[model samples]
Target chain A: MELTNYVVLATILFTIGATTVLLRRNAIIVFMGVELMLNATNLALVTFARIHGDLTGQVLAFFVMVVAAAEVVVGLAIIVSIFRTRRSASVDDVNLMKS
Target chain B: MTDSFVAPTIDWIYLVPILVVLGTGVVGVLVEAFVPARARRTVQVTLALLATAASFATIVLLWRDPAVQGDPATGGTYGVRVLGGSMVIDPFGLAVQGVVVLLAFLAILVIADRTSTGQDAFAPTAAAVPGSPYEDLARRKGIEQTEVYPLVLFAVGGMMIFPATGNLLVMFVALEVLSLPLYVLSAMARRRRLLSQEASFKYFLLGAFASALFVFGVALVYGYAGTVDLAAVFQVLAGGGTPFADMPGLVLTGVLLILAGLLFKVGAAPFHAWTPDVYQGAPTPITGFMAACTKAAAFGALLRVLYVISLGMAQSDPAAQEDLFVALWVVALLTMVIGTAVGAVQTDVKRLLAYSSIAHAGFILVGIIGFSQASLRATVFYLLVYGLATVGSFAVVTLVRETAPAPERALVDATAGVVAPGGESASAPSAPTGGDPVGDDPSPAVPDAGVVLGEATHLAQWAGLGRRSPWLAGAFSLFLLSMAGIPLTAGFIAKFSAFGAAIAGPDTQGGGSTWVLAVVGVLASAVAVFFYVRIIVLMYFTAPAEDAEGVGVTVVRSRGPAAISIAVCAALVLVLGVFPSPVLELAAEAVKFVP
Candidate 1:
């Protein structure tokens, strides 16, 4: 029943998500990693809200969910556009601009 | 034990300026849906300009309102807290909002301008595949993407709210609202469609990652302070008597994560990987808008956060405060070194400016690190001057185009004559039917057909620009020199004040000396001068490439709006440099933030 356990779990999830984003070659998978990171934050927020005996963190979790959904909409639109033109979802294929 | 339901009394006047912009954006969407296609561009432009002007006017009215100004006798801050302390309409945030609105207005003029050939910088149909027959058909039909006006208004609305909010949750929302429109706009370039899409993808991925980090940081800070309000978080950290006082590590990690998100938006080094790509790939006008307005909004949020952390730790946790300052100092030094060092080697004009913007971010950070009222004033002034020059320079960039070869020139003229009957079509045949596509041409099925012209971005292409169009070249050189912090330019004053504030340090204890940053910044300015001046030399000194080869830069004649924007920006850059006292006094009066 230690709330710290939940915080630890959230941290693990966040690290995994960040790692997936860095390592994934597919654009869609990388986007999913970003979503996973957001979800992990929501989990942390809800747990924190429970621990602190306040609704602010819980309310913030809902806002995060809404924002995550909006981000998914825009992110998928962009990825899909790139996919349509190039016929590839791989991140490496998108490299037309190099210094 | 059910609590009685009650509404929080809201201050309607405090919220009007933001509402006007967002409201105009909503109406713009309706305009796109219902208005006749032929009139949509005119309607949208007029609406957007009026809304921006109205918002700025309201801000001025609010500035004159006696109720908004706090009494210095009581030691109260110079602003009102509205929406139950979620939004703080203070002098500092108001000043930033005013600057954003004014810059957005000028940028809108650039965005609304069409070249003499009657082409804007946006794709005819943003969702259409680049080089596809459908896109070609849409272009031939003169289908302008008037929706850009709405998107800009929404972004401006978010920017207006970004610096004025005291609640962390609101700040996060404002960040998203401002950023999402820009992500889409980056991909909607009329030329170089594939590059634009790739740039949008890169910006989105990185931007989303930064946002996720920001939210996680917010969660941790909430856990530590048990509130999502910035002022409350400060109270908890400063008191040191709270139950969570032992969790300084948690607070520090959270703060760093949040700062990372914001710094990414400001395009500081290490997080500036997206800036050059996005700036070069996006439509030139959109690039100017993003460069100027986005930096202003992000820096505003950064100022609020830095102010809170420094002042909060002043009372307790001095060691943690020192650690924070050390981190900022390292970031500032790295940002300056990388921006100037790499900027010097860039071959493309847009990428060079992108790096210059990164360096400017570092200089502004120097001011922020000072953490004093004088520093606050200097930082705001720097943002304004920087925005003016950036937008103006990019406007000039939009005017400089790549001329077509002799054989393709005839084809472009033929197409232009068939497309629209106008005398202006004779000399304006620089469209991309013949030029080898910069990157892999994704859809080569449809020829570019003289509809839109790509900018001449390569440094060598600008060789004879001075001889061809002396006034335009002179204006560009002025912007570059201003950026170089040469004497008698607004950039010189901005750099002087920012470095001066950094050397002065905070008029308080606990904030460390930033004189070293000021010294490094001056040296970086010296390094940055090499590239900017190099461009000037290339433009004025270097002879025109052999015209017999038929590949040279062409300065497109602006219809009207872009010219006005450039002239205003250049004039202000000079006036502010020579007589900066008026704006400097305004900035001094507007340095106080509400908690």
Candidate 2:
């Protein structure tokens, strides 16, 4: 059972997104990283479902997108409010949450 | 794609509790937007109570229906395949739903009392227009703000669905619905001192950051597993730690990082730096609710991920899973030690309790460490016990009656409303406890009665507490004892179950742990005893603080509903402690979901 190359590429892209989230300071960039990761996941789900000849993976991916959309809207609203309140969005600059 | 075209069918019945909560949140937001200030209290509170009780009743009725002929969900562990085989329902999800039902009910009680009592006094207006009366003034009290309650319930409902969801995407949605309101509400305390606002702000900012992390993690796992259905992932991972066999190493890191983000929401160590500040800064009641309910919800989801996924990881090599378990055990260990030791040294009552909660998380982690298919009973039982105690402890703290406002920067949440500016709110006449800069006192031996006399002493001093608040005191003691793990208390039974499970080892068909960790946990608990006893000492041994430095100490009186919440939690703690079989049996019953 040979694994597909598409799966491997999608995973590498996902890793980049995750790393950006860990290392990036800019909130939007971090958010973009998250988006990239999510897109990578959708690709993997669709590709695997194609390989396995099962539709479950494809359906789950669709739901993931729907959720991603909701998260983005809410995330934007939260970031907007934090900016209004704290006047900044850099993960480190938002010191109001620290212990 | 064609499968999605069929439009994944959702079992509406399975989502009833979630819908009810969402409806409640919508109602709360509506009231916050449109209701007259004075009338907002009644509307938001009644709506919240009704929603919780109704959902609770629905859950109860689920059990009452004839098992054979009743609805498929009511009869067996009810499940609706929202996305065909991508997700399914098991009793594990249902058990968490039950925990949510209880948590929602308890949160309403705490929220209602705090809001009602603080009418005309909410968070102080920090950074108010300068050259104002507040320039030299400290934090102000808050006005009633029950609107946050229903919104919180909505989130709770979402969180409840989170662990139950078969799909990662749905789980993510549930996580957001549960968390967003909390981030907002943490900032809404009445004593809008800087600390309160800071608490909420930090909670929001960090919480948002964590959510992003979790989202990315999910995407990575989706990439590796190619589906979000937990069961399907189990099938994939069942081959062992090598579940992601063909995927690039990057995908595995994504899964672990996403887990880190989820763990943050649960306030597990390393990610837990935010716990103490937020707990200390938020209004005591809100702190309690968050500590208890939200933590439970987080753990519920965490358990599902580990047991459902990692169990397969464990099968790869029991020893490898053991190593993974060991890694988590270290995190939990640090959390327990840090939380307990720091909590023990706090001069401020709230700060002390916050640390104690941190320590408790470690104990819960102890149960979590044993998360094999067998660790299910231990984990679920421990959560039930630990969750109740956490709620109970917070209930006591909430009832203690705050004396001062947070720093001005703390009340910054109102600035974000963007709709109506929070108007001026009158302060509470005077706090029974001292929370401000105190002048030198003549009484040299006088204990910080506020710190010592925390449990029922505040109620005793200002609001007819000792006699009128006898019931509240009893309930408070029950919770206090539970935290103490006293025999015949729920806390005792819960702690026992977790430790027992942890010690039971991986094959025990319950939560198991290394004896070394469990013993360390026990020793750490002895340190916890010192603090729990401190509260009890204040309640029983210490005299109430009198007009020390002209700061009068009037006890707060508990209202009927508020008192009832305490009474019920206390009674159950004792009931479970006295006769552990039934509850423990139920915990054992819930373990089937583990494998």
Candidate 3:
């Protein structure tokens, strides 16, 4: 399997994730989109590490995973906090401020 | 051959300032766990202040020592590269770190003040649902949120590192460290809990996307250069020590992607949709902190990219340089126009200030894009001045409140046949508190120990504030004038230096495009003055309408930490404005970036 092909697949996954974030109304779903985007980057990093025969990118991937986990914790805390108040996890409903 | 690995050289002294802040933050967390709830706020406040001050002192020590300057071995023109080349402590980074610590200290003063309401800006317990019995009960108990103090220390620590890290990976980590606490902090407002949460959510979701984009850009850049260390990447991009094709496409794409993340952080346009909402919704003090320190950190990192990294690109490929310049120019132009044009019409003071911050971001970008030594010095000076003014102004914002009358007051006024200027009734109920489903309830029956007043965010509520509280009004006006770049103010020096850099930069770039930036900057600041002056006008010129006294707005008079912070900031702004030469010389000396 060519390492380059993995990069292509990762790119596709990243697009889907970004699109999901843009399209989804549910805050949880949008959060999942963010997770997917991060994972896609992880995939790309790993593939680049393999292609280059260097462990730096692979180490970076681990860091990304840890960061993503942290993001999940904070993101869920915020989403849950808001959800408890509004009784919904929809982004559109969170509109008390405007221009 | 048997593998033998040796430990990398460690420079403990170079790491001291960062470790001090982070260590204090950890200690604060432990303090949270061990200390009695009643004693927590005091201890946390002391710990945070000492840590930030200690870090600042350490930075001064590091700055004075010639042995620790860059690399003694090769006469490197940067600070000590420590943590196995993950961080640097050069003069530039140190200056920025100093600014961060100073501003953090001031911000902490504002954050810690409790005299006005015997409650800080943060919620007593962030986990409690707004308006829920749990929240009301916590409020009744006067449960102090000492946890925010630790979070602030951690955020400040992250900020200290964000602009100083030598590697992209560490930069990303520092970015999150700085950002996460802020997201949590924004949600912890004592009043308008729902708006606070919404702001946090929006900041989190959008900020996550920006982070993802940043890491993706990092991956691509790593792929292009085969390394993440900035110096090594610069070497590769500069065309002497690389193993990849010299195709500009890969590198340019990576640069743009990374810039997207950075630009988002600085609240530059196209990426600025979140700025107004987040700034308006966050607690005022935190908003001020975010407006000031975050931009300085982001711009510091940006300067490294442009001066150290992109300088290599420009030398190797003129076309790539032009592309980068043009991209930044468009973003800067849009930010200036959008910030001023939209700011002109905002009725909410916080939102209006938010727009003004975006405009200031544009002005800073003009300096950044100019890519000269003058620009660097101007940017650092501008950041310091801007941070002081911002933190001070927001302190004043927290003081002004619109009176929330009991529901019966509206009925009494209705029966009395009274009308006032900007007519309804002089006793017209405060602007419909939106989404506050319990609006008719007047004020919460939460039995807290201090005065409960609604945030007077409406511009009309500020009428005759100058008459009611002259000193507060005067201080706020000074900050506004400084922000508007008026003469005899700190903002004037910052804007003049920034525009001076922009004008000087066109000669090196071989195009007249940068001159356009200078003009836009000047015009934008001019437009900005109208809105800023409008606030002063509303405060001073408009008399309080009949029966509106104490009903429309009241300035909370408290000789608390917030007042002290405001006084110090105002003094600093005036001092710096009048005697800028000493600071300018220092900035000039600290202008060098380590490649």
Candidate 4:
């Protein structure tokens, strides 16, 4: 019943998503990790909106969904292009540029 | 049942400049879809230039409109909050938009240039695989990717509205609107497909991560303040009326997380891992555009966030503001130190400039923390000057070509006059074909067929460029000098005003500790001068080395649009440096943000 419990759950999901992003080698998986992080944020926002009883956070959540979908389009296009070229889905292989 | 649904009154005039640009971008997309391939390039270039120019003209008209003129001190009559408080049309945001538009115009000119072997820097077909038959076919057929023009217009439209957005939701969307096109554009470079793709991949991934973080920050702030509007958030913080006021921890975390995302966009240290690779890999013209316009837009948003959000809090609870100042102070220090130290050791010119841009970001942050009207004005002026120099310098970079040696040239000529191994072409006025091996040859026999040129990115390749293309070298040196904050250049004036403001600003901003940032900035500029001058020395003093493996460089014949853009940027830099008062007065008058 408490809103803080929802916040705590959202925080756990966000942490898992971030960890997945940091540890993943596959570009697609990494991208999915980012998507997961975004969804977690969305969860947090919707919960907060309910707590506040205001529509602004809900409106913001809609914006986030639209933005996340747009991001998926761009992120997939890039990862697919790289995969086609290098014949690998691994992020570690992308080492052409360094300091 | 429905008595009446009330609609929010919209201010059409307040939204016109941004609308004009976005409308032009939509028109550009239609052009891409419907226009014939042969006519698209000319039509798109003209539309883009006209759109930006018209937007600038509209901004000027708005400036002169008596209805919109308001005094900064009173925050009256000078700004119009429109779209039910989602956007603010104020002098400060307008000034930033002007800078973005002007720089976008010049960058578009460079993008449209075709004199270097009668081809632009972009790939003939971006979807074609490098070294594939399809790529060769596209090149042979002379296919041009005119989609870049529409993409640029869209990016510019987003940039025009980014700083002006009064709501966090609109700001986040605007950030993506600007950045997505850039990710695609960076991958479309004709010469270095692999590196370009790599850059695009890295930028997309990191950019998305940062955005997710941004949205998370937005959510937390919403939870803390119960509002998504910047002005509302400020009021909530100032009045201590937020439900989360008891939990100040939420507010602090939200602000810090938000700053993290913004700092990433600005290419400040600790989040600038993408800058060098992206700068090095993108088409040179796009790099220039990204460097100039992106910095201007990001700094504009940053200024709005710092000044508007913090000012209210400072007025009500001054102690709450120190946390932000301290965080920014540390960031400024790290950025300058890391940027200059890493920059000094770079072998590629583009990467060096990227580092310099990061250092410049640090300098702007100093201006932000100074927290005065003078600092605000100085920061805006700095953006303008830096944009001019950066765009002009990249235009020059596009002109210089890297050439392979005789043996490689023979192989290249053998390969049906296409690019050699590594997708490089030895662009010279004369080069021998697959004739007998020209061993130990200083100059090979003349090959009638011309070669497509790539940019001379390597520092070694630039040895004695002053002899090859004196004017270009000279222009490039001037830009480098300006970036170094040398006297009699726009960069010097930029730094002078920024640091002067820091010293004279109120003690409340940083209680005089801000002076230390200015000192670090000067010292970093001094160290930065070493690398910049080293390049000048290499260009003017050193001879082309005789190592067979060393890549020789060619200075491509001048293209009209790029030349014109360079000339305009150079003239603006000099004029601003020597006689900066008019612009300074204008910026000073327009430096106030409406909160």
In candidate 3, the residue pairs with backbone N, CA or C atoms under 3 Å apart (3 or more residues apart, or in different chains) clash, namely B70-B78
C-alpha positional error of residue B285 in candidate 2 after TM-score superposition, expressed in Å: 2.5
Please give the lDDT score at residue A13 for candidate 3: 91
**Range of the 10 consecutive residues with the lowest summed lDDT in candidate 1 chain B:** B416-425
In terms of lDDT, the poorest run of 10 residues in model 4 chain B is B435-444
Residue pairs with backbone atoms closer than 3 Å in model 4 (clashes): B69-B77, B70-B77, B70-B78, B431-B447
List ranges where model 1 is wrong by over 4 Å.
B1-3, B72-77, B406-452, B510-512, B547-549
lDDT of 1 by residue, B72-189 (tens): 5675556888985688899888999999999999999999998665678888888976646677678778788999999999999999999899888999999999999999999998
Question: What DockQ values do the models have?
Answer: 0.57, 0.20, 0.51, 0.51
Question: Which lDDT value does model 2 have at B136?
Answer: 25
Q: List residue ranges in candidate 2 displaced over 4 A.
A: A1-99, B1-8, B30-39, B63-82, B85-87, B114-146, B239-244, B247-255, B316-320, B372-374, B402-474, B508-513, B545-548
lDDT of 4 at B350: 89
Measured against the true structure, the TM-scores of the candidates, in listed sequence, are 0.93, 0.77, 0.92, 0.93
The chain B TM-scores of all candidates, as shown, are 0.92, 0.80, 0.91, 0.92
Which residue runs does candidate 3 get wrong by more than 4 Å?
A: B67-76, B240-243, B405-451, B506-512, B545-550
For every candidate, C-alpha RMSD to the true structure in Å: 5.8, 8.1, 5.0, 5.2
The local distance difference test score of each candidate is 0.85, 0.61, 0.81, 0.81
lDDT by residue (B9-114, candidate 4, tens digit) is 8989878888888898899889989999999999999999999899999998988665456754675567788875578888888899989999999999999997
Cα lDDT tens digits, model 3, B494-543, are 99999988888844564455767999999999999999999999999998
Better of 1 and 4 by TM-score: 1
